[model samples]
Target: MYIITDQLKENGFSVNRLDQIIKRNNNKRQFNTLEYFCIYIIMENIGLIVENTSYNITAGNIVFLGPQKSIEFGKAKGQDTFIISFSSSFYERSIKDSLFLNSQLFFNYNSDIFIAPFSNIEEMRVVFMDRMENFRKKDKSLYLSAAHNAIERLILDAFLHIPTEEVKKDIKFDYLYCVNKFKVVLQRDYKTAKKVSHYAGELNVTPRKLTEMTEYVLGKSAKHVIIEKLISESKKMLSYTNYTISQIAFELGFSDEGNFTNFFKKHTQKNPSEMR
Candidate 1:
């Protein structure tokens, strides 16, 4: 796939066509967990596995994937699928932007992937094409900002068109809002602050109320959410990095390696080294 923007940078945006990526890997199914968020626009029927769940995607469909979700793409030859990806640091330049990214439109704690149909496929394609052109201009003044605006437009458009039925009608909006905010805070502080009370303090709510809100919206307790985040990050590190178990434990804010090991094995039924 042709990358419209540089991929070597720490924080950046990129646009890629899926055909070349699949072909480059010998047309075999590819599995990955990206460190950044992604929006996939499908121009043909294809299969995708997100978080181990299979989905058959058709033409005119758009898929959103948050960071650290495992994804497997099925083979598709000559399909006009395109992906737009960006890092949190690249997109969340302000509090408003951060909250927007954490909104249900992009980040849903109960689900790692969100799929919707794009009724105006041609118009969406035009916007993506223009964005690719803008990102190609590395020397242009405010080129990155232009790219940001384009992506924001795409996200906002998706937000406006998301199917109402996808959301649970029984849940109250306040609980949904609180859970969304809790997710944002949990993601930001999971490395240093793993306690539910700490997260409640951050959101200016009682720990009991926070747990109730999380249960109401995500069908899990607030503490469960924190543990899930920890396990997810731990697996990524073990599978992708060369860090020793002790080092990883320290990095994740555990008091000691033994405690980390016990915790990991208790939850995942495997040692960190075995996972690696």
Candidate 2:
């Protein structure tokens, strides 16, 4: 199931009952909830934007979205096509994780990616379309929750094994892209790591490039950002959870409590114990 668009609404975000063909004349006219999660199952064809990324989604392909994603355009293709959207009111977290991870190749504008070709595409399409059809007809015999869960698992199971990594090599990419690469390398090697050289090496870029991107985009050095993220997560554990200081230390890649404490103090101006 592909979802798009979610906003705060009176009923915890209203939902649109989606099934059947949405005509081009009705395109851009918000049906269902303007501010709810959307699951888009395209059977025929539809080109739409999710989270700032454009998709020329094929018939029988699916995409899932979390929040603030939009779905514009109605399904209009030569062969019979079906597209379905599910709001978060019907969302499942495990499924959400699967959807988030599935998006790796595309540039994440506002949408993340999840797509799979089904052998029984037409049958699956009928099943989902029947859902909205039943909703319209008020199918008293169907147990709503059971039907929802079964479909959620069916779509996710096909697409949720492993995710592709984002492509990045040099500094001149998206601001978030560069920073995220720095974070990934930092977490991977933080146990035995440094200011900038350590991370830049893993990303195959120079320290100068790393520092420049971080400073320009974040108004702080990349070094400060890494230390801050580590310290921030550490503070949450120390203050919010009962994990031992040593445990938090090791989790953040500190070898010893003293090292952890000192590092935390340097960044946060408070000792771990005091923060706790």
Candidate 3:
């Protein structure tokens, strides 16, 4: 709901060296509720802290962040990066698929696959520079086609490198695909749909197959993914809202306040009251 696309209306795209962007915005309030898909390719070593996790950014490592995620600049010196940002509107216009964000390349906020290392750092720098120049030109109509292709190439590059089992025998591309689809489905139905079979029915796969796919690709079962997603939302509500525990329990589809507290404590190892 936080529309960051407003700053990108100049060309529906924005590219900047990370140091410059950081220097220009030196305010203490640095956490962003971004509304655009953003890619940050580290040109130098840096540490990126996001919520409860921190990523060690080295040269050639690119971080892909989806909209609505919170991020913070970690304590580091001489950090350099090339950042490319574009609105979902721009992405849909160019790609012709409004639901493209459902893909594993875009979402899956729970996974460590957000960062991937690329060998051709210099070549990528050239590619990003060329795209930036396209945004600068006045008559940019001609650049649209070229820019679209370039963006797709970059996106494809990121998708191809998502971490999977190294043993080719264990790598089932269909399972991977199904797991990603399951992620999208879980995001849409996690609140109302609790059973593994419920999601398996939606994906047209058996509950066992879905669990295997999730374990293989994400090191967790389908039920674990659902519970994690629900608990994540519960924590957000607990931290940000004035809703009472009973109200939150009812909203989250819990049978009762005690049941919600037990479920929360089982996963988080702390009661909801302690969290608040």
Residue ranges of candidate 2 with Cα displaced over 4 Å = 1-35, 74-83, 92-111, 131-141, 164-276
After the best TM-score superposition of candidate 1, give how far the Cα of residue 133 lies from its true spot, in angstroms. 2.2
Residues 1-276, model 1: lDDT tens digits: 222234525336766677665665566555453556788989888888775456889998888877655677876763578877787788887755765566665676556677767777777677776655665665444656776887787677677665666546455756765787677666667889988899999989999999999888778899999999899879877876789999999989999999999999999999888885
Best by lDDT: 1
lDDT of 3 by residue, 1-276 (tens): 123334467556666676556666663325453556777777788877654356778787878776655667655443357767776666665322433444555665555237767888778777777655755474566555455566666666776775554223445667765776676566556767889999999999999999988898778999998998889879877887789999999888899999999999999999999878
Cand. 1 TM to true fold: 0.60
Assess candidate 3 and give its TM-score to the true structure.
0.60
lDDT string for model 2 (55-106, tens) is 7877666555433334455445423543334444544356343343223322
- TM-score of each prediction: 0.60, 0.40, 0.60
Clashing pairs in 3: none
Q: Give stretches of model 3 more than 4 Å off.
A: 1-7, 27-29, 75-79, 93-100, 163-226, 230-261, 266-276
lDDT of 2 at 249: 84
